[model samples]
Target: MAMAFNSDSELFPMVNVNNAKLSIEEERRENVDEENRRKDLPINECMGEKDANLDAIIARYAETINKYNLRNLGYPTNQDFNYDKLAPLFHFHLNNAGDPFVGSSFSLNSSPFEVSVLDWFANLWNIDNSEYWGYVTTGGSEGNLHGILVGREQFPDGILYTSQESHYSIFKIARMYRMHCVKVGSLFSGEIDCVQLEASLLSHKDKPAIINLNIGTTMKGGIDDLDLVIQTLKKCGFTRDRFYIHCDGALFGIMLPFIKQALKVSFKKPIGSVTISGHKFLGCPSPCGVVITRLKYMSAISRDVGIIASRDATITGSRCGHAPIFLWYALKKRGLIGLENEVHECIMKAHYLLNLLRDAGIGAMLNEFSNIVVFERPLDDDFNRSWNLACSGNIAHVVVLQHVSVEMLDTFVHEFIEKRSIWSKDEQFKPLCIANDVGSKNCACLMHTTYHITFSFLSTFVTYPTTHSCSPPPAATSITVLRRLQPQILPPPPSSPSKDSDLTTVVLMPTLRSTTVVATVAVVAAILTLSLLGIYYLCLTLL
Candidate 1:
């Protein structure tokens, strides 16, 4: 059955239960044995040229990365790119010191290419060449740093507000600047909770607000509503002068413009700056990014620094000039139509992967405008390592990049099904119920399916008032008492649906560590204590 999703971005992924503890132990042993097959050479040790140790090491390293690349499905990096044509430029020392547009006395810089690349992005982001001032950054993090820094420079006492699901770089940038940072609640889809954002804005009305909105989140691929965010600011009484909005569209920035009628990122909007990575969807061979802000804001960062004989505006004095060339090449080669085709192809592949998982009796979810197919985490450690999957506690996702084709997806699905079947032994495996995380309707687990499916993330109240006798420990509250001892006792499938309907409540303990549990409970108030930090940041979902 298909895992249907609501507009709110709820995802209840189904996972197979652990049948044998011994099987896991055996797999761990095998994994340890396999680790010995690939020995790491000590870098500090001297290599004799006569033995060809250097050549052997390079060959082994190349082979390993190639194999890993074949199975790579976790990260957002688009691996379908060729830079062989630009490899000739690697011989020279091409460094864009100081500002990209500003000509340096050092003539070895490739600032012309850098400027051209910046112009390309500026045009894509709806910023005119004459009206915008920006340079090719090291990557998305640098772009974020520069964008947010400009906001801080403009409004020195501004409070940085970002969704909790934002890239770690946002918070890191906040810390680096030593500015007051406010972590806002987000929807399960990873988009910013504008309701919560407005409340946060209202609370911090005394200070200037600097909002960091995601073009697309790192984990769940959620796109924060720019229009709604702007509306939220206005409702909270922050005008154009008092607030600065910096959009971090690291992955989605380039993709969004190509997407027809997508949330338009225009200079016409009341946005301070926009940033995106060249490596992510654009497929730059090296890490590179672009940040385009109004020409007016350039004065805050740019000034004559005598040593470099140019404006010292960027985060780093010397930038990787080659990165710009690579980005330029990618933009020139793909053009607008080529990129649009790749974007459509990726979204299609993501939908196909979702179907493959669902048809195999696994619950999965794909957001309406995302290429990230989120599913239940594989219980086996070796299986995760083999695919190089990126997994959180209960969920694992496959980012369907341009290189991830139907054949590769087919092989992955087939292998996953085969391994799961062998592990389960004639359909003995019970599935984990994630009704609390995703809504009940989407949860394909035996218990969740049997129960009422009307409950939502914030409203789904599961009370453990029953002191019903079980082989368990004393009670903290009804919910935490018996479940804490062996929380994840997933029930086996009943012969009939009516067989288990007599039971009032079946506790589906979440797969969260004590630390993650603290964060999780704080997010969605399942219990009575919803008000933490004077903010009712509701639970579950991906946001």
Candidate 2:
């Protein structure tokens, strides 16, 4: 019988397979080494000729900024935007200070000035008491990761619980620590469901549990009820010590002090630890986050893990000195009253947009607690008719719908509507004739189109033009050609006029004028075309 062939048979029968594999791996290592050598080349040597190219990239960006109407936003285009004030506060030279890899070196130590500032931040969040303690991190994600790590350290076998709409980082942190995560459903009012949370806890009663409560969720800006969550935990016989509660207050922590006063609730509470991101509402350019835990729990994990002192409690080694400094500066600059005022303004702006949508008869959903508001465009009879027309002809009509919640929505909707209006008017002016004119036959087509376009434009105009000088000027009318055919029957208006008042009377004036102008323009165009054709024919004959 012929020798049996196997899929794993080596092509290099003369050489050792293991050695061959090792040789190839060595070659790959050499290639990587070569790449590293090339990368290590000095910037000036490697990119000498590309300096102009780099400058051109920035120039092109600037040109694009000019071409598009994006000049009003206070974003910096060059490097000269007040770097002196911000640069010294950064820990960019921390590694250069001393021998970074050494054990317990004084040069590698963190700034005591930074630690004092962090202490202030902890106090600001109501974590200064003997029962509470916390330290700064690079960002909310890192802070959350540290929080979960602490949770896993305390309750090694616990399942991490959070809302379905919680930040993705929560689940990621859980996975990083090899912990099981249980997501509970959210409420209709855009909050974590207390009942579902209770059920989740009961279902996972066999395992130690850690609840990751989000103060401000990414989507819908939903806030989980901490009071209810605490109550449910108590009902399940899970005390603060038995089950850790990590409050991910990244976006909302800075605002809590202000909001708490309005709600008449103390910020100091039952949660074991809370994480905060300074960049979201704190208006910081660099990343800065803090994790606040009870003093007992903090003390338990205070042992230094390498360069970071044991008591540091942060996830990373050699923490950035600037984070705590920035946090301290932000807290001091914007005191409790200032933060409350800013949050109040944001809420007011959000409510303004909600009111505008309501006044415009546009259906929308507004979150009562937080500043976020979400709403879809109303599919009214007029909108449906226009949409149907576009769909029937296979023309991709842009959906004039949006979803937003909070004060940010007000600004977004306003800008969106303004840009949409300009584009809509531009589209209307284009004389592209559709093959099927089903919905085009309606007498109210022009009016309805104009009305919708104007409505969208008005919405945008209100929001965007508030701080900017560049406002969309009035629309200019353009002449468009239409086929001459017998007038089609028009649909009756939804709300009929009074019996005494004639609907026909008011409609005839504009209808007649429009018809006359359209006819006159068409006749003129036809005459011009015929004249040109006659002249061309005569010239051909003469030749």
Candidate 3:
């Protein structure tokens, strides 16, 4: 039951959800590996004479995970972590069902570690313990649920406002809570359009606003301008008490605080709450997230649960006590310096991947201060599934996490280029233009291919006058977009000039005038010395 439709829309000429699911099921059925299925393993059914062969099964599973981890780039989960030291603790079952600050009667709980983790986040977000209340949830989705629920409880009649590019969970939360949701538009970068928001806010000026601002969007890794969003709310006559902001920093939440000049997400700002994924930038063995909000809003959400002998405000009952310890270990080990270094490393690797993609004539985009690198989706489904690429419409993204290395990125790019060439040659296919998706400057499709020749950062171009006097270079009619090519690897750890000394800057021009070079030989020979005299000044304008 497969249907094929054709159109220019990104959503069209694609696999339908229902058929895709059926296709996956059929594929799995047809390609079932009997050896890998552990069909011979026997489970001990209630005192029956059967051996589970648990050891062999566990070893097989471990091997499979190790193999999968190498190619797992579609998701943002960080695979570079270890919690082997806490293996003994896994023997006991633990649950922190109630509020972390208020310890529960369950003595087996790891509430102490949980509280410490929450405090660290609160302090990180610039909130005093007395003024803040938070808890570790299952993962980012729960954190979002908790944050938005707190907002709804605080302002019961508030209308939910979120951009079209927001995580799918936001709309689900809206539906779950039965709140009137206002879907706002977004810019090409996926940031919420402040103008559209202002218009929406003005249209519904009476209802209180519960804005879910994206610290980093899902696909494009776009960070909604928090400052601009706040400004728009105020300009639209929504005052301090009239609105609430919940910063969904799922991808960049914890990472942004470390990056220089990155938009600061803090309690000091008028933001009501902030949520970040523990397994994202801050890698964890388990799925978890933290959500912190103002203490003033606690009374409306929190309540004394007689059964648990503690306040039950969190979205779930019996939260994973093990998750908090895992988070604590990661934060403790990384500290500030280690975490900062990891974030910086991921972003640099992303840049390296982007450079590789573009250099190979494949269109790609990497956001400023984001680790997610977006590119044109591959035509071959097998090639896409082999690397486990996360795709939407005509675009696909590879979230370069701490585990993603230069070697792996190189391998991925090489394979992509090779496979892409084959696919295009076979079909005589034209590369898709993603100007509407990313931007004109980043697109490499046929219509926009000439733009690449307009300006490249790798070549040095000299515009010389035939006369012996210095002449002003004639300006081109079209504007050229300038791009930088930073070093593949950054300088080695903290406080050293040795690394900086090894670096050199090279000017690359995409194209040069077709003028004669015979007259410039006198200039080319003496030009090295003469160029140095004016190179600094000339570069200012030419670059």
Better of 1 and 3 by TM-score: 3
Scored by Cα lDDT, where does model 2 land? 0.55
Q: lDDT (CA) for every model shown?
A: 0.77, 0.55, 0.80
In candidate 2, which residue ranges exceed 4 Å CA deviation? 1-84, 88-92, 95-110, 129-131, 260-268, 299-302, 305-312, 361-363, 377-415, 418-543
Worst 10 residues of 3 by lDDT: 477-486
Candidate 2 lDDT over residue span 408-519, tens digit each: 3454446545544664555432222222221222112223334444445433312222223375422222222222231342233338777764332222223555556546
Predict model 1's lDDT versus the native: 0.77
Q: What value of lDDT does candidate 3 attain over all alpha carbons? A: 0.80
- lDDT-based ranking, best first? 3, 1, 2
After superposing candidate 1 on the true structure, give the runs of residues whose Cα lies further than 4 Å from its correct spot. 1-52, 425-430, 435-438, 452-543
Instruction: Choose the strongest candidate by lDDT.
Output: 3
Output the TM-score of candidate 3. Answer: 0.77
Candidate 2 has its poorest 10 consecutive residues by lDDT at 71-80
Q: Compared with the true structure, what per-residue lDDT tens digits does model 3 show for residues 432-538?
A: 77888888887877545643443231123332333312643343321111113223222232344363332232212323431232234335545554444365446
Q: 1-543 in candidate 1: lDDT tens per residue? A: 999665422332333336533344456655565664553533324445455567666777677778878988988888888888887888998888898787887788888888888888887878788899988888899989999999999999999999998999999999999999999988777789999998888898999999999998887788999999998899989989999999999988888887887788888899999999888888887788898888899887787878777877888887887888888888889888888998888989999999999898676777767898877777777888788788876677899998898998999899988877876674444465555444455556644533333223322333333455453323332233234443544344344646534354443345444335434544555332323312312312212
